[model samples]
Target: MKETAEAYLGRPVSKAVITVPAYFNDAQRQATKDAGRIAGLDVLRIINEPTAASLSYGMDRKEGLVAVFDLGGGTFDISILEISGGVFEVKATNGDTFLGGEDFDNALLQHLVDEFRKEQGIDLTKDRLALQRLREAAEKAKCELSSTSQTDINIPFITADATGAKHLSFTLTRSKFETLVNPLVERTRQPCKDCLRDAGISAKDITEVILVGGMSRMPKVQEVVQEIFGRQPSKNVNPDECVAMGAAIQGGVLRGDVKDILLLDVTPLSLGIETLGGVFTRLINRNTTIPTKKSQVFSTAADGQTQVGIKVLQGEREMAADNKLLGQFDLVGIPPAPRGMPQIEVTFDIDANGIVHVGAKDKATNKEQAITIQSSGGLSDSDIDRMVREAEQYAGKDKERKALIEARNDADTTMYSVERSLNEHKEKLPSDVVEAVQAAIADLKGSLEKDNLEEIREKISAASRHHSRLARPCLGKRAAAARLLLGGRPEEPRKRSMRRRSRGTYAESNSQVVVRVRCIKLFGPWEGQDHEIGVRHSCCLIAVTGIQSCTAVSIWAGVLH
Candidate 1:
């Protein structure tokens, strides 16, 4: 739900109240904010999982303790809160990091597999695809059980033979299905208690209990909620649409479409870095509404060291290693200082999108670096720009010319090797292989010595790309096999040679050493008009005497070895 909302920002949809899982930590919440910023948006406010449900319920007149139990595909968040004068302040929220409707679906699928295995005596768990189809069916059944009380799910024709033959089937009921997933559903109590305590409320204070995620629609789920809250929960809001609707409403808030509506939110978890005592020095704590900034310093750990490595971490852990490695950097070439003497002021700021922007500077030198954090496998703006520049530079090169040089080199090497291989392995290879390789080499040679550079480029590129295919029966595994066998693979020959063509390499891998001689060569000072040509990249060791007196002048064009 939050992923889609993040996308809606800065596009056709102008605002939104993104609902985060009640258990989302400050870092995760901040990361979501970062995602929003990247989309060029202002996250009006982050709505907690349960509060979003209350807002969408349209319970303006009713007043009672409410338990908003939301179970998602991969997370469970339950919050108990009150509604007074449209103020749906949450009293508390709790959840599991990895428990929800998805778990129940998986469990039910497992149960089906077990039942089938015991009856038919066939263990089908090894079939991934069959398992996936079963999982999907199980989920569908779970959803059906939510409102209808019972539904029969078809688990037909799963296994298949190479000839496309299918082999099996079954069905499941609500009570049996609930029994399979009941343990997972019951795991939400701890967080529920924690959330209520966090909000300074209890089951008695929650004026009206509400249900949120699609999983909440389950009769078994509702029974549990009612038992805990001591009242029946509101089932009015669509389990799937409430969070989205709340987000859209918040979007309306950001656009000023809804006036006099202010949403003040809090940080979700503690944020800080490891300190000397291995303690988390909390820069920001749970429930602190954001678009915030905080700064710190970097200093040398040893005397005279010129660089200090800086690693910015997230999470509420005293040890740096215990936290997430959001990013890494170094303050380079610092003035030499005594151990722990250099000061580098660093700041880690979290914007509304929850993205961290870190900056650092040497207090004495004021040398600095700044960058935004992106999760692994994704590049930051700087890296993206660098990639763009690299691509442009590569595109600027004459690919045609480059391709020609590579192709010609291929032909040259292959011709030399194939000729030698045919002589050495002639006995083992078939006559056709030898003859074909010889013919291909002849054509490549002609192409290389061709007059037109254009034709040469085209043919060379074509030949190099296709060489492996053409040079078959080159059992010797030759790089120059392109010039060896006729354009195809063949069995191993008696022997084959792979000799590199050498007069000069096709590339200038190493630069030639040269001297830069700056000179203003006086051409015709005596020819009525004095003229000088500025020459650079010249040899200076040679001394030259003038032998010029007119229209044409020549200085010693010394050739250096």
Candidate 2:
């Protein structure tokens, strides 16, 4: 990252604000900071991926409740935030760090491999290169099907059979692909509901929904989001570039290049310590706003307990042993006292950088121990220096190897998708389209054998562009037919309904107009009910259905007008 920045700016770069998964624990976050230092970059702060994506979206807009749904290559994060006055305050965040687009690709890959093995009696999974090729093909097919209703997956000489060599070829339609990944996408629903519950808001209350990450481009993902939120997800920002744009925005905030923006993030997990019977007692709860402090008092459990053991932990589990131990310290030299007599205060302070500082004080003796905790599972300074020197030494060679692998991987994916398109649409495609696609495929294949990674990348991108262009008409036709089936129009936006009613004991109306607003509880003990109020004048009431509690007009009545 440092080298990339330096090369791009034509100057030395030394500082960065990195983004990580919302579910990353303290160890993972610390590891990220250490990695930044290893790359010769000063880590300013660690931010959450969903939060960063939200920052990107809220940069140009203000005053909306947004739910950020980010589905990346291997992780899914959902964050609910209230944006107002240039402040992005996260209400709740939930995610599955292991769930992402890779899972979709793997599901398709497994299906293809099974089909190939059954027909040709060849298990492609037994060969690493064959499996890798199939994975590339599967990912490309997935991406292509996002824009088109149907796509082909074709890999030449993917594996060897008893006869000689065999190729894997198959047709994947959008419907079938949706079936394959729908279950995986469905996995995000629970988290969304959970986030709403945590935020004390309903899905209907969210004013805007933002989708980010590469996988967010999938039409199926958009549909699922709409089904859950009852609103269309915002397409104003690019899913792939939004996070980086947000990080850059955050960097600007740090350098004072940007103004009037405030970011408030939360800790992903609870921070606590062990108490009596090894029970975990939390001081700072998960999702609590940071640059915050919380302290809990404790008494020694054993008789004549003089010293208290402070073991810092992180996680939501009840048992201290089941959670991750962040760090530990001891408070000693206390006046000997019976059980439950000594007053020991343990305070946890998490700063802006998200690093923790623990302080333990004995009120009787006024003795204190303050420790700046780096990490319980982080590498030491010497280890970081060693790794950095080693990386610097081997940087050139590693870059070449990485670039070559990436180039080959991209070329393989593009060629497979292009070949699939050519095979399935050959009869219907224009002659020029057919010739151009075939030539592009051949050129990409030829570039794979050369040592030039840049050339390989260019050929792969060119082939992908041609394939998308040829497939666009088919996708358009499918979309048009669906629109026609749905009354030749797109879904209309829902409007909030408001009504006016005259308020009187005998229902008498006057020449004056008045407004009133009421809300009702939709579920639970007070379900299907409205608040009763004394009628006094002609009024208008805007009854919002999705908010949590039922309420009558108060001082808010005058403001509604």
Question: Highest TM-score: which candidate?
Answer: 2
Q: Identify the runs in model 2 with alpha carbons over 4 angstroms from their true place.
A: 370-376, 389-561
Clashing pairs in 2: 515-540, 516-540, 516-541
* TM-score of candidate 2 relative to the true fold: 0.70
True lDDT of residue 487, candidate 1 = 35
Off by over 4 Å in 1: 1-51, 58-67, 79-94, 127-129, 148-151, 160-173, 277-279, 295-307, 332-346, 361-368, 382-561
What is the C-alpha local distance difference test score of candidate 2? 0.77
* Candidate closest to the true structure, highest lDDT: 2
Q: Residues 359-404, candidate 1, lDDT per residue (tens digit)?
A: 7788888898876666654555565556556654775465655776
Instruction: For residues 145-255, write the lDDT of model 2, one tens digit per residue.
Output: 888999877664465434443656688999998898889989999989988988899989999998988898899899999999999999888888888888999999999
TM-score of each model, in listed order:
0.57, 0.70
